[model samples]
Target: MDAFTTAWAGLTGWIFETLVQPAFYALGLMDWAEDAYDWLDFGLYGLLTIAIVYLVCRPLEAWRPVEPVADRRAIRTDMVYTFLARLGVLPLLAFVLLASLQTRWEGWLTEEGLLPPTLEEIFPPLRAAPLLAFLVYVVVLDFGEYWRHRAQHGLRWWWALHAIHHAQRQMTFWTDDRNHILDDVLAALWFGGIALLIGVPPGQFPFILLVLRLAESMSHANVRLSYGRLGERLVVSPRFHRLHHGELSAGAAGKNYAVLLPVWDWIFGTADWNRDAYPRTGAPGTEEAMATGGWVRQQWAGFRRVALALAGRG
Candidate 1:
């Protein structure tokens, strides 16, 4: 592990100095170098996530697809969303926009002598067991995600943006990232805020993302696979999440809101444990543009829906 960490750091340093540093120098933006370097690591991790998700889920999809590939165009649109997200377009935007707010918030807390304690600080035994602590962080973050997902469905205006995600009739592994840009930003804020409050380590954050991303992509896979009865309750499966995307499960009628773990759904009464069901996906009343339009068109339609919903005309 130490060797791998050293090699990884070497690679990141080499790439930054070889490419990013020169670009910063030429653009007279050395002030932003530190943040850009951090984002470069995120970008590289995003690439690894995309590769691992595709290599694992794509084969399962081909082997046991619940639905055939009837809408290539729709799948292509989802691929665009995946690339935009996994290539760091969305993360970079969130980082740039949130960095100032985070700095100010941290500064204020420091001035007040109220800087928060990490989970490790609260539970000192966690310091002696890194792997266990990582699991705890995963559980906490997944719990936050479950509630955030419920809000996306329960709140009308948020649902307006979130409907784009449910509008995909041809959901695939790529469909995991098929969210409205505004919804993505809001999600980043919600998730990042919780991470900040709990003091997740910067090194562990990307791995947490990787673990969740792989699970989410697999959950959205077209493949019809489920962890058997006992296993299904432990980890979410494609069978479980596909039902969440079922046509009739849109908006306030949804279930299975857990992102990585199914325990939250089971505990909160949102789980559907039918291992035999793999219902057709898509939101019933969503605009056609949201369901089948190009990326920009879908974004526009989602934005318009939010506008109308906020105006009480949706």
Candidate 2:
């Protein structure tokens, strides 16, 4: 392994030994010394697995031909909007952080108490069980996320929050974060709440979030990274996700919405792989439809639209 990989492994090992092990011991689950063994196994094994994935997948992504689109000014505008919208996530983040701190401070909450106990908590039989569990949880959460994405398209109220994401006329990595604060809040609540209720471990939560963010960033990246059939089945590709943002007429608006997995869309009959026949991708509704009195006015208009629908006004 290279210096960076070695350092990462070492750090991961240390974290498992110091933090994870102690937590397990406090829960009266395992001996403290086992933590060291767990750390070393996870650090080395995890590093090797990720390294192999990158080595094999990176080249395939590079070989795909991607069409280039230039619209810097529009992209920049979208970035600004996204940045502004992300500011809304701060309060929600704070709420989650506070809840975490409270759970930790209480001391009554064991590792298992947290939704989705970490691999270590779930499988104490084998040293490698935690590592295996970690991988399983990643896939499971991705599956869950795919359904959540589909719901956002199928439900009208959910679409209100998701529409903020599609508001951008341009696409880029940062464009992925461009969403209304309410939308971000609802998304966090939906995914995190469901994961917690299902007992997903807190330790594993970070890994899940990291994987999702990496997928989101990669899918929105300007560079092309198509993995053809194999990639399509395994993970969501940029092309598959781009179809979700396709600008179609009213009749064909909410088509593809799966995030990390395409299976959900395919299963639900929402998959759209007709790249050659896809309409030009853009935000739905006209510029005038988006333009209200101002930002506040537009926001109010959106709120009113939702309220009216709830009251059966629309």
Candidate 3:
């Protein structure tokens, strides 16, 4: 296994040993019920994240009012695509399960024993360094994610899974999660792999995941949460991220692909934030063409189209 995988396993073990176990004991829960409680906690939080994303996007109607595409049917079609995309979550769950198994079987390395160190043991200076380390860790993790995202676009085969994400005709918070099953699995692998390689303790992964998810939801939100010029310089805002979803105008479609930081886009020359002109949303083809064949057929058609182009038959 890679260093990231090793560290992630160690960290997860540390988290359960430290925070989760203590919490279970304090709550007087049955020893056997701890795992169930953890699952419940994660599920509840996931639903809450979805609800928050919806709430944030609902208000965008009034803020930066643009002419609705006058295509309710297309919107409905996109929603269906989004629903089908939820099936992608299954592969993500599988990756999580696999990672857990791998880590447990391999066991953790420590100074004195084969077992992973406890959270306190791993980070003895938590009182002085927790916040600082966390901030640095978050930035590093975001940077890794940014590069992984760029690779998905630049690499031809990877784009197949990613194109499902871009299939959305509308850009909203929910659009953030509209990825293919393969895409989701690859993403988890990247994120989890990187975290483990860096030796991030298990206790920290949950909190990090929480923060990243919230930030991702906020980035895709349709609400007018422009961070002004200064805020845009520091972190990604809705305005900045929306440009990534903007349709190609005069051959400028693949710009602004950064996830958490606009700095990467700016540095890499992909940033295209034009506040002066409102962008047109949706993919290249018309909704009617996309919807005629139904979801499965449409996906097959898209794949075929790409294949033909690759074979120089288009």
The candidate 2 region of ten consecutive residues with least summed lDDT is 286-295
For model 3, residues 101-155, the per-residue Cα lDDT tens digits are: 5576446454336663333355567547776667666777778887888877776
Candidate 1 residue spans exceeding 4 A from truth: 1-10, 205-209
Task: Give the alpha-carbon lDDT of every model.
Answer: 0.91, 0.56, 0.60
* TM-score against truth, every candidate: 0.95, 0.62, 0.68
Q: How close is each model in CA RMSD to the real structure?
A: 1.7, 9.0, 9.1
What lDDT is obtained when candidate 3 is compared to the true structure? 0.60
| Clashing pairs for predicted structure model 2, backbone only | 115-199, 115-200, 115-201, 116-199, 116-200, 116-201, 117-201
On TM-score, the candidate that comes out on top is 1
Q: List the residue pairs that clash in candidate 1.
A: none
- Candidate number with the higher TM-score (1 or 3): 1
Query: Candidate 2's C-alpha lDDT?
Result: 0.56
From the highest lDDT down, the ranking of the candidates is 1, 3, 2
